[model samples]
Target chain A: MGSLLQIAVRNVVRNVRRTAITLAALLLGVGVMVSIRGTLNGLQRSMKESMVLAQTGAVQVHKKGYLKNVLSSPLHLDMEVGDALVKRILAVPHVTAVAPRILFGGMVNLGDQTLFMATLALDPKREFEVCPKRRDLFDARAKAFGTSADGMVITVELAKGLGAKLTEPAALLAPDKDGALSGENATILGTMQLTSPGERKIGIVPLPLAQHLLKMEGRATELAIAVDDLENAPLVAAALERALGPEFEVHTWDNVATFFKDILFRQDFLLSLIATVFLVLMLLGVANTMLMSVLDRTREIGTMMALGVRRSRIVTLFLVEAAVIGVFGGCLGGLLGSIVVAWLHVRGIEVTMPTSAVPFVIQPFVDVLYIVKIVCLSGIGALVFAVYPAWRASRLRPVQALAGG
Target chain B: MALVELVGITKSYELGRTVVHALNGVDLQVERGEFTVVMGPSGSGKTTLLNIIGCLDRATAGTFRFDGEELGDRDFNDLAEIRNRKIGFIFQSFNLIPVLNVTENIEFPCLIRGDPKKALRERVRQVAEEVGLGKFLAHKPDELSGGQRQRVAIARALVTQPQVVLADEPTANLDSGTSEQIIDLMLELNAKENVTFLFSTHDPRVMAHARRVVHIADGRLVDGTDSGRAEVAAVAGMGAR
Candidate 1:
């Protein structure tokens, strides 16, 4: 250590009780901040992954005018599904899987009760390659899934609300592209869970059955493409648009899910507020401790002043001491936080999200970049707080201080 | 010219609307290499005079000169520079930094002056040996006795090779034996190095070691008529001036 740093160390070591108290405050503040940030990051990651895996996949492909009138479920805007188009999209780099879907809205009747529901028809083999089917997610009979020619799947919440059972008959009433009311009969296969409680009002069936019911043969509303790395979804979407031609439009999950974006915005705002509060509190703690130390050392400071030491050197001395405390305490807190986050990463935290239709589990993630940022923040806060006290010490008159006034 | 000359110096302070005059038109002078003592009772402004002489405090109105340079309007920074390069101070309580060892405390002034590192170590060692603290260089202030601590203070004062060393009651806290020993050591340094010494005290034993005695009472210098020889001569010189 340099002479000044050595002097600061010795002084800090001489007052063990004060040093310990200051260190404790800094340690707890930094540790809690790091852990909280890690947990929030984990929650955000789990929510985004859930939405992508269960609904939008990484990107969605649709006809040029399909999304504008999608709420009306206009069958005239549906794209004709040819094997060549599917093959061309599948050939795009990073395009892991592509599943064709036809979406429609209608009423589901279980004898005494009739409920409005949005419906999705998918190809069993291709859908399984992209997203987990209801049969794969739960225990059901072998024939309950995979192109039974007349099977349907509904959310568990929807089944309970309608008082329906598996292998039972249900009726769906919807409109065809020609403005005719059409009805179809299906047997309930099984039920599954979804992230959004609002999505409970949905049912699923095979693509061919939906085509037959709507009288729009060999047509699909949109194609949901899965990418091996979801982070590269935009690039793949761009490539898919070029390969599938300008007749189609591409939409990433971020554009399709406004709810997730809103939730993320709120989460980030709350976390930032928490971080600011912690930083301010820690800064005050450091400032208070240093001010008291200066009070106790008034005579000693006067002696230095009388010895011809400059005022700036005195201020630098105190600042260096505070920075030392910050570094030591920050490292200790970071280690403790990392240990906790590591434990959560393995054991996982089970969270009951009321907005989710099912139980949500999140394993808290530890971001190295976030940890580094907090450490820097803590160190800088400590220095900033020391400024006032150090300046106060430097301005003391040697005559008054030496006389014990 | 005298090494120190203070003429008509006055200092006052406001304490809650009441003005307290600490120094009142005090005139004094001391030639180079003089071992002088300012003797006074309690609250006689001995400390205030010493503070002004040390450049740690400024006079409210007066013409004060050191080495024939007028210091009446010098700023605090210039006064600090003058103290660093020309004068050394020894407080009555032996104000050594508690955290630093004896050698570090002795070399502290040099460090503030930004002296060369290698030569500063040798000078510090020489001073430590000169003060008979060669073996206690690594000992902190608390580990040493009262007299030993005072010796460390003296070494620190002399380390900068100052032209004058001002001590405020250098023996006020010591017993009779230690006080005599400290006085003897200071006398030896004064004679060997030809360094001027100015100290304040009420003790007769302390005054006995001084070549000239300047008496102070009620913030002004009084004639030392009671003493003979050196005192009467110094008082007569002031009277003539």
Candidate 2:
């Protein structure tokens, strides 16, 4: 085995130009695969973080039928947010914090102009605890708005549409649970700069004020839950469901953002397709090199055969040659790829997604195990591609091959 | 029993629509330790006969026995094993693996047979010394002279210590002096080590050194009492033709 490896290594080194070409192909293919995977991972992670931190926390708990009628903002499906329910939810493993929110549709009156808005009313301290980055969403003027329960914050676009100014008193009118007109007066404390299109006409108020105006003193439409780790959200949600029973529905952020999940699935499919193409190209390159090597060494192969070398040994020789190329190329490519990813991660890539108002930075990173997997895949791919060529080398008739050049 | 035997051997090849006969109905044998040469013109069956006897090829029709074992119906791999265990081959081109140095090249066959590397390396070194390549063990094929390369090939063939070493025009690519030295080396090994040597060569020098010479023409052996004179005449006649 050691001698075979020595011969294989020497054979690969015999033809410098051809081996370099094959190594380059493998290197580029594996490098691109790693880079693409890392960048996409970064993009997916960034998008999920934005969605979880600024909008939905890691998981959400609501009345069993609430999400079914979520678009209508059904007051009848609201759940009681009493101290006992909150304490029960906080008891679930992995659950870090929970914020109860009242979701409603209201109209902000600005003299002759009235603006329809989707609104969230939540306790500021609890919401901040559940979604740490939520504070970043508030504009400069609203930095102190969460301190006072009577103050409200509307989206910048909605405030502009209503011709409303910060610190100005506004009348918010909505239909209460009894279907009667209910009104509340509050000072527009500040504006929020939200990126998503749906949240452009949104407003936020204190939980106490919303509960009073809606005549539901202790009820909220949903409880957004945060877990210690984003990856554990689904497990925590399942535990919450089992703890809270069938009266409430527990959803992970991925389930709540259905469109984003679809986008993620599509991205993964596209990545696989790209990876397949690269694999095929790399296979062809390595196969071509091995076949050419066999042809050039036909007489040498014949000589070996005549010297009592077995056909199986000939096949092993060629396969080992390919493996050498694969291992070297894979390791070097993975190293270079990891370096590139790390560099990009440190100096993040800013991507301006069509739906987002400001560009988000994607910090690409490839873990050690992922790089190892890619290297092994590259090596195995080379071996698979070399089988035909190795078989061809082994099958050559000794007499004919000797007679050949 | 003869160390090498061939009875009524025939070989033919199909080139397009023409069936060319390369060898026909040749019977030959050589005892152990005999230095024999099968001499013929280029179109004769010298190489085909050597190939069959060497187990590198199978005759189209014949009874071939090496060391009293029949090999007429052996498969390719079986033939390979027989060749590996019992036969050694020397080519006209000195087919040493260019990447391997003299020691590695000499030990190639043993390595292929999975010999213990430590023991085989010592034997390979001894064989290299026997072939006058003791000082060039670390030199690759390209770094050696034509004679030195052929010495490497000879070392490789003799390292296996097979019953017979088949040399097909071993000195065909060398100058007269080198060819003389190579033939002398074979004769010395044959006389000293009792190693059987069989060669297919048109070189008169090789035929002169052989204890027995078999002449062939048009794929059949030509009987002559004066084998050397007859072959010289045959060569001159062919040149005239």
Candidate 3:
């Protein structure tokens, strides 16, 4: 067995050019797989973080049938926000904090102009805790704006449409619980920017003020909950549902952001397709090279067989040669891929979509164990592709092979 | 019992629609420690006879016994075992593995049998010395002259110390002077170590060195003799001079 291994190594080294070409194929295949996986993983992480911090908290709880008519923000389906319900929610194992919010459609009047607005009324202190990055959307001057000030923060686009300025008074008009029109006066404290220009007609005000103006005191349409770990959001949501009873529906970030989830699924499918194509191409290249090597060594094989080497040994020799190429190529490719990933992670890849106002920075990363598994898989793949050619070499008749060129 | 026994050996090959008989109804016996040669022309059955005797191929119809064991129905692996333990082969092309140096090529047969490496290396060096390849142990086949390469092949054949060594026109690729040296080396090894030698050739120079020469034409032996013990003694007397 040792001598056979020696011979196999020498055989692989005999034709340096062919071996190098095969190795290059394997190297490029593995390198591309690693780099693409790392980049996709980074992209997924960035999207999930944005969705959780900028739009939805880790989980949300709403009254039954509320999501069905969510666009209308029906006040009839509102849940009572009491100390008891908040305490019950906080009792769930991983739940850290909960913020009550009222989502409603209203019209903002700035004396000369009036425009429709989608308003989210929440306890500013609690909302900041549940979604820490939410405050980053506001301008620096409004960083201290909270529950103490009786003011509203409208999106820059809405403020522009209303021709409104900060510190100016505005009238917010909407239908109260009894389907009667109600109005409230407040100061426009600041303006905020959203990721998408189409979604910039939003306004945020204090929870108490919106409840009073809508004639629904101590009630909110939903509760956005935060957990210790984002990855365990679904489990925490499940526990909240079981504890809060069937009257309320609990949703994780992914459940609420269905569009983003669909995009993620498509990305994964495309990555898998690319990986499969690379593997098949690498297999064909290796198999062709091995078959050519077998043809070239037919006479030498005959001499070995006539000298009493077994057929199984001949098969083992070829397989070992393939294995050597696999291991070497995989390691070198992995090294090169790691270097590229590290550089990209530090430099960051900024992606700008035409519909988005901000560019997303992706930081690619892959662990050492993942690289190790990829290398081992490459070695196994090479062995699998070499089986047919190795068997062909072993099946040759000594007499006929001796007569071959 | 003789070292090799064959009776009514017949070999046939199918070429498209017609059958070609390369060997027909041949009976022969070789005793232990004899240097013998089968002398025949190009289209005769010399190679087919050697192939059957070397266990590289099976006879189409015959009974063959080697060292008291019947081999007519042996499988490929079983024949491989017999060849590894009992028979050695030297090829006409001096077919040393090009990547291997002289020492590695010599030790290849023993290594295939899973012999102990340390002892096999020592035995390999001893065989190399006996074949006068002691100084060329580190030289690859491409680096050596024709005669030196043949000496490497001879050492590879002798390192296993088999009961018999078969050569199929072993000196066919060498010049006349080199061919004489290779033949003389084989004769010396045969006389000194009592190693059995059976080879096929049409070269008169090579045939003159063998103690017993059997002539074959078409497929069967032309001379109506099998053992040739008396003829071996007479030729042995002349070869010593």
Query: Which DockQ values do the candidates obtain, in the order shown?
Result: 0.49, 0.68, 0.67
**Candidate 2: tens digits of C-alpha lDDT, residues B103-167:** 99999888888899899988998999999988999999999999999999888888988989999
| DockQ preference between candidates 1 and 2, better one | 2
Chain B TM-score in each of the candidates: 0.92, 0.92, 0.95
Q: What is the lDDT of candidate 3?
A: 0.86
How do the residues A141-214 of candidate 1 rate in per-residue lDDT, one tens digit apiece? 43366658878877766788788555567887788767788988877777766665456678888888888888
| Candidate 2 Cα errors over 4 Å, as ranges | A91-93, A106-116, A142-171, A185-201, B225-241
Q: Estimate, for each residue in B196-226, the C-alpha lDDT of model 1 and write its tens digit.
A: 8888898888866666778888888886522
Q: Residues A1-405, candidate 2, lDDT per residue (tens digit)?
A: 677789899999899999999889888888888898899999999888888988889999989988888889998888889899999989988998999999999987765667888988988989988877776777777767678877888887888898744555688888988989899987787887774445578889899999999999988889999999998998998899999999999999988878788888999999999988997898789889999999999999999889877889888999988888888888888988887898899999999777655578999988789889878877788888899999998999998788874
- The order by descending lDDT is 3, 2, 1
Per-residue lDDT of candidate 3, residues B88-177 (tens digit): 888899888998999999999999998988988889989999889889889999999998998998888888899999988999999999
Chain A superposition TM-score per model? 0.91, 0.90, 0.85
Q: What is the lDDT of residue A260 in candidate 2?
A: 81
Ranking the candidates on TM-score from highest down gives: 1, 2, 3
Clashes of each: 0, 0, 0
Task: Name every residue pair that clashes in candidate 2.
Answer: none
